[model samples]
Target: MTRILLALLLILGFAAPAAAAGDQGWWNKDWSYRKQVTIDSSPSGINATGVIGRTVVLVRLHSGNFTFTDAMPNGADIRFVDTDNKTPLPFHIEHYDSTVGIATAWVAVPNLNGGEKHSIWLYFGAKTAPVAQDEKGTYDPDYMAVYHFGEGPGTASNDSTANANIAKSAPPGVDDAGIIGRAARFPGQGEVQIAESASLAMPAAAPFSFTAWVKPAQLAGTQAIFARGGLTIGLNAGVLFVSGPGVSLQGKAPVKQGDWNAIAFTTDGKEGHLYVNGLEQATGPAALGAIAGPATLGGAAGQPFTGELDEVRLSKTARPAAMIQAMADAEGKGGKLVTVTETAEKQSSGGGVFFFVLSKLEGVDEIVVGVCLILTAISAFVMYNRFAYFAKCTKGNAAFMRQFRRMDGELVPSAEIPGLDKKEARLIKTSPLAHIYDVGIEEFNRRKARLGNRPLSSQAIESMRAAASEVVVHENHKLDQWMVILTIAISGGPFIGLLGTVMGVMNTFGGVAMAGDVNVNAIAPGIAAALLATISGLFCAIPSLFGYNYLNSQVIPLASDMGIFIDQLLARIAETQAEEAADNAMGGFGDDDMAMMEMDDSF
Candidate 1:
């Protein structure tokens, strides 16, 4: 038993250190809550590969994915940090409408390796947090112009980069229900134009990439989506086409009409590539001379596109195919590139496993668990008290029995016992056998005084026996005191716990029925909380059961000792009376009679 206990203690000691070591401490003490966001770029997810350094990825938050109430209104408290939990990342919120539970933010990851996984942190729940939006910092220097089309209907789209390449013309039309947010609408005649600038100038055969989410209203002949000097990206019969200074490339497969598709065109100075929905659809050798002109979206003139466009980005360096694919997978609707978990809070001074579990419990479940805890405490107290009482009784009885056996047929007064000492006397005071012997001796003296110089009759001895038996019964009562409390704890603790579990489960199912959603994610927490009640019940009952059995076993032996002591005490009193009677009979004759008897013996 000792070895088993030491082994368990060692295991617990090691486990605590391991748990503490795994915890990367909270990012900020003031922020109360955070969520872990995992960006999976493996084959099972986005499946992009290459050195995709300092990439900006979009993070979408909605009611299904985030708990809006825990965040401050307008989302000023929102902060993004790296997996190290110390380095703060650059991010900007494009849109946040807490009332409707929808928001969008862009975060620049320092490094995103292809075919691997990375993680970041989202911290919130602070009341006095400063706004940390860094629009230009969220994007790298390669991005020349990026437009989200989130401006008001009559306002020109604002560029998100440091170049300040704002649209020169306001969009002629606007669609509120665009892909990510509101989008710029085109009606085959109007266009969004950006004037020529130093940032927009393209040198001869320079590498560049352009991408936009487009939803075509019409797939008519050769409609332009973007065009500049010697460069045009248009659609004919819903198929993608890109034209440069020396080459023209067209995709064989047509994009689905009226559905949002990611259209991209890239030129590495000598070759051109066209992608639709993140997949490479067409490629060809394409070269470009100095292209310096104002850019037009929806068409240069009569070739205007009759469609809506959102999230148009222009990069000076030709982005890798994998980077483009990752962007498409992350920003599109129902994309699985990012996964966010439930919010976790920083542990306070009073926080531990018990408090954490209590946070998950509802009101009634709390009461149930509280009651179970009280019962457990009570049972523990009873067990300790009873165990101590039993130990004292056992020790005292053993000591008194030793002294009684050394009496050698004599019933001596307790104080006059030959080997008695302060410690032994104190022990014998608690002994039930000692008390019964005292009672028997008192009864023997009373009967002997009432019948002076006469032997005690069998009836007299039986009377003294009855008196000792009465004292034995009283001692047994003392031994059995407070034992019922242990029995109650053993039998009732589990049933109480079971009651709590039943109620918790009923409430959980009722909540699920009212919510009208049947997914595992929605119901798992409730079920786990319900099961905690049952676990608590078992915790209360099992220990009580063991304690009651052990204490009961100890009480039985003490009661048996009391009964045996009473029997020995009555038999000793009867034998002493018979010996006294024999002595009196031998002393009946005087000295003359003794001398006459001696002469007769000689004859």
Candidate 2:
């Protein structure tokens, strides 16, 4: 039992558990064509292609080591790099294949003899290899790449033999070299090459499909890929038909050049037709004789290819155009193509942020500011009213005093004035302080009642004047009290409000520090709230201060004037005292005595 347990434990320790599934690591990389090249006199080439929308990358290493750090699945399907710079012949990329390259796509390649072929795309990922240096400094070739696009030795002798025999590099009616003469891959002949090795025989009993990628090389070409006699059909950028004495069918819409175009050619052995991007572009008569070469890349023998060729394919049965179109659509929809569009579109949704921010301030801010400002304005107005009240009070008092003087102008004599008492007049003129008519008449009457029987004296009259002055001072100060009240209301309220603002600002900035930003977006609103209090305070304070000061300046002088008038009354009465004493003995104060009191008091 112990041995069994130990064995189980050992097995458990050594065994690996199933790993959690994860996202694919090969997403969106541009390793579509990573051909490893070792050029010996420019003989090396890469034969690879991608779907219409896929990326293709081809590299040549001259004896340098390469490292592919990408952790891809299946450890990569193909590696084609050569490190030693030893040039090799171009490798064929079976075009029109649907399951072998970076992306599986159906394509059609037309034969020079007019037979069409179909193949699919292939995928080859990254790998690494180290090279060794030679005595002549030429490194031993060691590299890892993905595909091998065909290469040319800059001459027919050094190039792939099949590429050296083309009858025509530019066929008749091919107007633009931009579409045709362009390199298939850099330094490789975009022109067609004909050779015996590229042809294959179609079987006697089966239908066929041909597929490849092409850019409409020329607007018009005699026979891009065609055949004659009993053996087949041809294919090309724009037209497809039998290469008879003269047989051609042009594409309804010319194959677009300067862009990768996917073409599919399918036939039921009776009617042969061409399809571009999954849409039937043209139809032609199939060769009605014995089957010849079933598949041929580039052009027919002696004719070879007059244009670039990659990923040529041939299927034993005709394929539907919709299936090819679906694949094309899929390629068009890949993230690589969409990425550029989405980036350029720049669909910013900041409106959401704006809405969210404004939502926070709904109603509260407007309501608060409105109420505060209104209250402040009202308070300010109240203070202003207080000042105006005092202003009116002072002016009224001054006018009242003047009117009193005017009324006193025809003052009733002691005899005529019904209000004067007899004791008030008996000693009114004998006193040295005589202008105190208001006080003397009252004092004598009061004296007569008890110890008031004593006669008046100049000192007593002077004391009376001083007493009236005090009363005037007290009365004058009454309306001016609003000054102090208004001053406190205006000045103090705003200060308090400012204090609130300071506190609010401190809180806002403090929170800002905690939140880690001082941007206007973060700070403006808080500062606005803080400042609201200050605004309220000022709104309350300004009028208060203005009115308070205005009232104070106004009321003080009125009080002073009243007191001065009272003093003057005493002096005028004093001057008339001797005359009044005689007149009192005569038992009368004439109109002159009252008139003089009124005039002196007006001063």
Candidate 3:
């Protein structure tokens, strides 16, 4: 039983370390960290309705949601993978400023169902990773022009889609403080235009959608935000209005002045709908003939918008309302549609169960846990050694007692017992009872030599018994050697562990108070790491308590056996001496001589 228990413990101590959390089949082993990105379209989130087919979604990263220090400069190491963690998805970075800790990337998702959640993986932290930006591939072919307005001043804005619909002229003004990154600021004087191309050309009554984030500086007369041929999406008296050849749709929901709003207009060739901030504001029958003109943004030849424009997109197909809603929910300020989880580090194959906890521990906590581990090792060693020693003593004592019982009344040496083999002889030599018997035999021989033929008196027998009793006491002291170490472990281990835990918790709260952010994520890891010290303490103490009791129980019986053997040895010596004295007193005349004389008289 002892062997089995020890074997199990040894196995646990040396078992192969496991990875942190379950295996998710990492996309690539080279990347050292990955974070899960979830896009929630459920009721609790954006609540987008209907199936939003393949589309490009923006992933915004800032100091609040991302750790900039983990990624390389300019986010060159960044890679987006699908939920399967094996397939890489196409993504392109629109803006990345590591020093400011803000970035925005657009990734093409295969599908997003309403009332459902979609997940993707963002892997980074590789030192030698190559740049994986796919600008053209990030947007579908239906997208005619997608402008981020992030280019430097006086430079024409480049389109991100496959269609190279660059701006015909630079913006008159540029605002670095735009909603996402940079925006084209129009002071109601000049406008940016895109020359008509095969991709930008809209046929008669064709499906079309135009969306942009607009912040109107003033709401007075009509201001054209977008226009091409006879199609014009403008703001009149702070209200949204879209007009084309035979289409005239006006929105009742007024655009908030001096604030950004997602303005969009989508027409399915039969009807046109206007949206403000992701909600449908107005709808009416609309149609258009073949349009032939350059697409103008921020103004036309007569009306110029006095505001900022950003993230302007033009699609050949009329985008679904759900997609527009999702975009508005995700790109708006302080949006919650996309949630990026905390980063997870890659674990080596040799990592242990406490590896993560230990990594989080402070220096003082590490020292405390180290002490507990040392105590655990000490206790295990003591328990194993003591148990083995007790087993040997028990076996030898049993063998010695058996041989001594067969001696009848003779006080003979343990080695001279009949039918004894070398093994039994060795057992008797190490047995405590055999040692006590040898002490008694030596004292008896000393008394016999001094008294000649006289028997030992009562005083001499008492003295000899006292000598044997002293040997039994000495044997018990030897049996109890090193048991104090177990007592120390049982009593002191928990207290030591508690000291570490208290110190760790103090450090954790102190750091939090210093940081002045009291969120659960900021405090949970520290508290959990602090508790590890207490666990280590219990780990050291529990097994020692059980082992101490078990070993002490085994020692008690052996000590009792030694005492009993001492008493029997003295009693047998006294009985043999008394018989010898009686025989001597009768002048050596045996019982046989008396019986023979009585028979002769009868004849």
**Candidate with maximal lDDT:** 3
Q: State the number of backbone clashes in model 1.
A: 0
What would the per-residue lDDT of candidate 2 be over residues 1-603, giving only the tens digit for each residue? 212221222221432232221223222133332222211111121111222221121121100111112213322333322222222112222211112112111111111111111211222333332221111111111100111122233422112122222232322222111111112421122333323323333544346665555543443443344332333344443444343322234466555544546666666666667777656777776543445422233445544334443323444455555434533332321211101000000011122222222222213333433444554555556666755565555444443344335433233323344444564444433322222234544543444355422344777676666666555545645555445556566657676666767776676566444332234444565565566556555655675667667666766665556556676665544444445455555555578897997899999
Local distance difference test, candidate 3: 0.81
Tens digit of per-residue lDDT, candidate 1, span 1-603 = 222221221222322211221234788877877778778889877788887677888887754345567789989999999989999999999888876556888899888888998999988889899898899998898898999999988999899999999999888889876777778998888889998989887898888889999999978788888898868898988899987677699998888889889989888888889998889999988777788889998777768788899999998888888788888877776565776653345535223333333344655666666666666667788889888888888888888889988888667766678878899999988877788888888888877788754666778778877888888788777777776766776677678767877887777666544322233433455555666666666666788789988987998888888777777877777778778878888889899999999999999
Worst 10 residues of 2 by lDDT: 337-346
Poorest 10 consecutive residues of model 1 by lDDT? Answer: 12-21
Cα lDDT of all candidates, in order?
0.77, 0.39, 0.81
lDDT at 42, model 1: 90
- TM-score for each of the candidates: 0.57, 0.31, 0.57
Query: How much is 471 displaced in model 1, in angstroms?
Result: 54
Q: Candidate 2: global Cα-lDDT?
A: 0.39
Which rank order by lDDT, best down to worst? 3, 1, 2
Please report how far candidate 1 places residue 286 from its true position, in Å: 2.1
Candidate 2 vs 3: which has more TM-score: 3
